[model samples]
Target: MELLLSNYQPAVFKCNTPKDYMEEALKICETLKIASGYISSDALIDLKRIIELNGRPRLELLIGMHYFDGFTKNQYEAARTLNAFLQINDLGFVYIANTLKFHGKMYSFTMIDATKSAVVGSSNLGSLYDKVSRQYEADILLKGEESSLIHASLEEIITKIGSPFENVPVTKFVEFNQLLENHENVSKVDKDEKAGILRNLTGVKFEIPIKSKPKSNLNPYFGKGRENQRGYIAPRPWYEVELIVSKGITSQPGYPSNQTFEVFTDDNWAFKCETNGDYSKNFRSKDDLKILGKWIKGRMEESGALKMGTPVTDNVIAAYGRNTIGLFATKDPSIWYLDFDASK
Candidate 1:
């Protein structure tokens, strides 16, 4: 049990080599609020336990495009049961990437809450290499907001292009078995060999290894180009601001509890305002933001407020959850805090 903590430090773990990947991840999920990972058998047992626990957490697991290679009767049954459990709890859903496009093996898992953690390693979700006494594998747990961006990126990837990995409506189990038993060239091969066959068939490529750097004393959550906390808010690449042409909901991935606004930005980035210097209260409601978004779009299309508009630095600010009131011309630097009455 190699537990770790830090303001922005990342912990590393190993499995079947030095540590048990499943066990450590299970311990972390015991208090998990929201989690996302590449689905495999390595962590399925623990995922089941976590979902069954009280106060089921939100989860989204990515089922690789070639999930049927290691198909077995018992594993099939387990998957069926797990799918049922997930649907019943409404805690999460598994997704399968479009094989035609995404063919990479996703082996990452993330647990995001007040404290964030990310694990990237050599193990898949298979029991063969996930066991304590199995093949060698390792995982890294990155803590704090530094990890939030990565987790957010994963969420964007899964939800944007993947389809639900459901067994209902028409069970994938049958299709899986058919593919397994009918492939003359690979049917006789073991699960491991079948995995290789699937990869070959899909033209999957392993990600290139990244060279690690020495640890730095600077906070990982804050970028190196830190700005003073005097007046203007710092621009976060993760928290982008954009003017959405269409009316829709916008939310930051890891900060689920923060207030969300529908207000359109000059860029597609969601707006985060300064609410008395508090972080959580910076959010605005979608409906309220839409009012402002509609106004901005109308003005932009009319070429009125945006006559000289360069999308590069356009700004549509809104104010809510406070007493501040102001609207500004594009040239007005003082219009940094844009406030509009939603009631209008």
Candidate 2:
């Protein structure tokens, strides 16, 4: 019997506004009928907007925060917006953050799964860095089996990490204390120390850089009235490429360093380099070179990079020598080499 598998479709969006992101997401929501979402530190703002625009309806929402001690007034307002949305929709929302306790501070990972459709993104729900970043930087819409998995996971997490505010009824003045007590992950420090760490980790934490927009120009071949341009007028296909570099620690000190750079086409298959760089510089001995070579060759063989039916061979490597070497170290003793088309 033939086995069938479900395809994964992950969208990468480059957008400038919350509205645009929401519209795109809403379309996905309508198509997939998403029932729940998990929001990390960055996606809370847009999540709130989505809930509000969709008539403040109940949905499964799980919010995760790394730290909460330094949130500003505007940031607090964003949190209020989120709480209001949850209240009106009668939705389940979970806020996870590190907090200080009267005894000892602890960090907690929280979750809330009250709705079916869910969204996750890389934006915060506040004005903490308004001029620098959007309320939401990016979003991922989860549906079908994946959506169900996320919901279940969040629910399980929340149940395990019981909330302090679960049954408490408190006024505004005591709400902060409630949050601190409820969110086990929040930490407490003096004003001076908090400011110092804030300054030190400014750009390293949660600061998404604004990407410059590419200049758009009309294609000469498909100008204005040429809406139905045929054949070669189609846009070039996009390719996703990755380069991975790693070193072996288990082997002796003289063993060669192993590095791999892979180029993946739209098709799933990858054009991989099995052994095309020098490891002698780091290894400093022939034994290291041999060990590294053996290790790399095994990996390539396992990946079918040097398979019998495959067209890629030492010839192809020799042809791409310049490009391959450019990706690795220059001073290594063993030059880039390949041996292909060997009988099995």
* Top-scoring candidate (TM-score): 1
Give the whole-model CA lDDT for all candidates, comma-separated: 0.35, 0.29
**Taking the candidates one at a time, how many backbone clashes does each contain?**
15, 23
Q: Which stretches of candidate 2 lie over 4 Å from their true place?
A: 1-22, 27-49, 66-69, 98-143, 162-344
**Candidate 1: residue 263 Cα off by (Å):** 69
Error of 1 at 257 (Å): 59
Which digits, one per residue and each the tens of the lDDT, describe model 2 over residues 117-151? 44444433332112222223444445445466555
Q: Compare the candidates by lDDT and give the number of the best one.
A: 1
Across 11-101, the per-residue lDDT of candidate 1 in tens digits comes to 3333233234444443344233222223333145334543554334456666544443433333444445566577787767766554334
Kindly give the stretch of ten consecutive residues in candidate 1 with the minimal lDDT sum.
Answer: 210-219
Residue-level lDDT for 293 in candidate 2:
25
